[model samples]
Target: MIVWVCYSIVTLIILQFCILLIRIDFYWKNHRATSVELPFVSVLVAARNEERDLVDLLLSLENIDYPADKIEFLFADDQSSDRTAQLLGQWCEHSANRSFISIDSSQAALYNENGKANALGILAEEAKGDYYFFTDADCVVNREWIREGVGSFSGNTGLLIGITQVKAERMLGRFQEIDWWLTLGFVKVATDLHIHTTGLGNNMVISKEAYVKSGGFKSIPFCLTEDLEISRAIQKKGFGIAHQVSSGMLLKTKPEASLTSLMSQRKRWMHGMMTLPLYWKLGLGLQFGYFMGIIGLFIFMPKIGVVLALVKMALQGLFLHRFAHRAGERGSWLYLLFFDFYSSISTLLTILYYFWPSKTNWKSRIYP
Candidate 1:
């Protein structure tokens, strides 16, 4: 009975990968590559003690290829004890095209322990662009990030979610960069194929009309997974979400510095997943079954498990090989292999951490 069950699970896992591959192919064929007029865009950034990277991010924004008159950058400082506020003031005093708005600490409310969301809500009200573009304090946008994103809004795209790539400087950083690209790329591709669509908060754009129709950030003011919540809300309202594949629109983020920080970040992500609606959660389970099958093979049938593991590894290798090329990291297969193992262990720890709730400190703020 045990052997049969294990084999059945392994078969299911193989089938899931097959489905994913087919979906990617289908999307590539039917996807509409459209170009639209560059409308006025309000670039919204929420910062909380991001002194180290704020200036770099601001400098990157200055070089964007979009028209200066068509773009407005809004920086919302969530009461940073660091020089973030001073830096913003300095930039605003000198910037010819950007505008700055700081959120007073007294008015900034703690909504589900995520300060970014709180800061975003306040900035949204003051925004004047036809579209709202959300990025992070530590992210550096490509020169064409805004232009490519605005182009996606051509016909009926209500929300445009672009790609995020990690810029790694060390061994740990490279591992994280590879893991993030592989995992997120797979999810984005799968979701584009009628699976489940999720938007990363760091590189998402939404029309102001859709924002109002979906009830704005007020809809998920207290949700830790604000991006996912907003995506679902927009989907519920029947707005189309599209992904931009052009590398020009990529938002590069810094990887977590330590194992503890990585684990905490993963814990927050997994916990947020638990809060997703049932249908979305169930759909993700179909994807996760592939991982579960590998674990089952190790436990019940060593020989079959070894064979299945080899097949699984081959499939993963193919996926990573293709992904690495797209990410401009070709010849880093060996690094990706090790990173995959680290990701598996980290995912398991994240699952466990979700069951046991505890406070975590990040950037001098305590989050539960």
Candidate 2:
């Protein structure tokens, strides 16, 4: 019975991986670059104690290739105990097109801030744009990020998710970089299938019409992965969702500072599990437990386990190659072997941490 279960798990995962590959080419198939005049855009950033990296984001925003006459910037300092507020203040003063809001714990409690959600809620209220583009403080978007993102949207698209990668050069960073490509590969195909799609918090855009229809952040039930929740809300409103992964729309995020930090980050993401439907939840469960499934097979039937693992790796390598090309990234196939080994450990740790009793700490705030 155990052997049968393990075998079933391996087969389903491999089948799903193959399915993604088949539909992968269909992603962005509907995207047609148009010369139509774009709508006014409000660029929003939510920062909490991001002093160390806020400048990079500010610089990126200042250098955006979008027309200044039609663009505005709104930032929120979520009770940061550092120079984050000061930095935002200085940056906002440089242009009357920019604005900033500071939310302390008292104000957050009064508004039911729910961490980043409240900050974004306030920012959105102050924004005067037909569309809102969001990115994180730890991220550096390309100069063309805004222009490309606005162009990626179709007439009916309410939510657009862009690809984000870890840009660090360390061994750990390389593994995470590959991990992002691999994970988002699934997300991209899911978007194509128009099923199980979620938002990329650090690199996403939502039309004001859709945002208002979704009832804004404050009205959406609070969740740790605010991006995913908001995406689901927008989708529930029957708005079109678009996914992008090109060089123009791609963004870079600083890698988590340590293994502990990464673990916490994953823990927060695991909250997304509670938001998925039963079928998708089960499918994701199989994915997260796939490594364990292999081990179970190994204990029961070594040859079958070995064969399946190798086949899966080969397919993953093929997907990565294509994924790199899609993102215009100079990716290395060497990361395949490294990711194969590293993923086993990280997957197990992420699963274990997700079930632990400790609250998830992200950007210095704790979430249950």
Candidate 3:
């Protein structure tokens, strides 16, 4: 029984590895160069009580290489209590190309979408650009972000999912970085094959036409992972969606400050587990089984369990190392070795919360 279980787990891991390879190959073949005369771009940012982060992101936007005349900046102040509204007003006053949208709390309750989704829905309607780009308040985008990202879009492409690198200054930050990278790597590969779905709210670019055809954010069911929901909606409409993993396209964002915060964020994300494709669910189950198998086997047959754990770490490390190098992110090979064990604990806890959700808190809003 133990041997059979081990065999199944190993097979699943290898299958996942093969899928990653396919993603890399497909991306290279399909990646098109950035268009010279790119369409007018609208950079949309939604903020709530993010005074500090918003200021940084706004400063970064000021340095973008895209033409000021061709690009417009739209911001939504989602009923913030702090200096968010005042800061945005000041920003718009200083920048002629920038504008702000106000989100009325009373009217916001009428919408069934998530907070960010509600803000984005309004901004999308107000935007006058041909292409819509999104980034979080906490992220610092590279100067070439628009130059490189907009170039990859073709007529058929509806969505362009970019990469994000976690700002890791501590051990916990490192773990989160590895976790995000692994999740994204698998999803990017699976996404390219149309077998699995993944998206990050921190960075996304969608065509205005595609957004309208997909029924927009208001048309989709509200989920904590609105990015994934919108991506699926657009793709279902037969619009092409592509994943861009180049280093230049990577947006840098701060990791959660504490374990509790990280877990809360993960729980919110896992709350939408049902929204993922069957193949992604199966892959997650196999991962769960693999970790459980390691614990059970270790107790019953110490040697075999140890062997399995070591082998799994080595295989995982190789892929993570390669991904880190490709993305120009600094990750120690040593960190990857034990990352699976660390991640398994969080994954198990997140799965438990997925089945029995706790209070989800984000942007000062709590959902019980």
Candidate 4:
């Protein structure tokens, strides 16, 4: 009796996941960037301790093909103890429209801000463009980034979310890359289906109107995931959110090199994830628990366990194959097995660490 009940639960988990995979949406399928308006825009980034990969960002910025006079760039050094400020100073000096801000104890305290939130809030104040584009210092964007991003906007779209992938040659890096796409797959589908989509700060765009309408970051209370908060605020202002999954808008970012670093990253995100809707939270929780649940079935009923696990993997592989193709990336079959194992362990640890009573660690700074 107990054995049958266990098999039933495990089967249900995979069934729900299959439905999610089936529902994953792609914008590139029927919709393409068709906007005719060319508005002035601001490219903004906030960095602390990003000196290591700052050059990559600089090179990518230089390669951008946007109009010099029409677009302005703002880079902020959030009190980095490294050469992040020095590098930005040099980069910003090359062009009149490019500038960087340094946040010191006085400025940060005056705003009473969370690091990233404070930095972006300051940047928004100085931006004169019609649109604000935001990315991370560790990301590599293509020449068409600005062009494609701007083109994807419809008149009603107050916010646009672009695709961001982890670029790496190592196995661990590959795992993170797969993980990113998988998560974004769900986000894209939910968003297109009219479900609320939280702002993804790494590769995101916001119109000045929506930014102001949402009262921007400064008006909101401090939170670790400023992106999530800002996105919700924008939606509340009755603005539609647009998502882009095309190749031209694809953005690549460096992966965390170590498990310790990866955990810290996930911990920060999971903290923000608490703001997710109940169904989403439950969906994500069950997805993480699927593997552990299978273990119980494997003990109680070996044949059924083996069959369900294999079927789930095959379904996921097929889903990701389509997902990767759309993102202009190559899909891997073997990664499906390894990813399940990796996500299971990491997710379990993240849950434990999330409630273990410690401030979230990010960019070498601790936040409560």
Reference-based TM-score of each model: 0.90, 0.94, 0.93, 0.94
**lDDT-based ranking, best first?**
2, 4, 3, 1
Model 4 lDDT per residue over 1-368, tens place: 76666676677776765776666543433235565567799999999989899899889989998888889999889999999999999989899999988988877844435888888888889999888999999998878888888887776788989889898889999889888888887778778787886888989899999999998877767778888888888999999887788787788999999988888888888878887889888878777667666887789778888988888777777777777777778777787777878878888888887888887777777788
Error of 3 at 288 (Å): 1.5
lDDT for each candidate structure: 0.74, 0.84, 0.80, 0.83
Candidate 3 Cα outliers beyond 4 Å, as residue runs: 18-30
What TM value does model 4 have?
0.94
Q: Tens-digit lDDT track for model 1 on 1-368?
A: 75676677667756655665665545542222466677888999988899998978998988999888888888887888889989988888776656667777667674334677777877888889999999989999889887777766645567877778788879888887777766666666755664556778999999998888887676575656678878877777888787765566677899998888887787767767887679767755754555566677788777888888677666666666665454445536667557546766766777677677687665567777
> Which 10-residue window of candidate 1 scores lowest in summed lDDT?
24-33
lDDT of 3 at 5: 79
Residues 194-301, candidate 3: write the lDDT tens digits: 553755689988888998899877777878888888888898899887877777688899999987888789888877776676766777888888877777777777
Question: In each prediction, how many residue pairs overlap at the backbone (N, C-alpha, C within less than 3 A)?
Answer: 0, 0, 1, 0
Per-residue lDDT tens digits of candidate 2, residues 303-367?
99999998888888888878877888867777776687898898789889988889888777777
Candidate 2 at 343: error in angstroms?
1.7
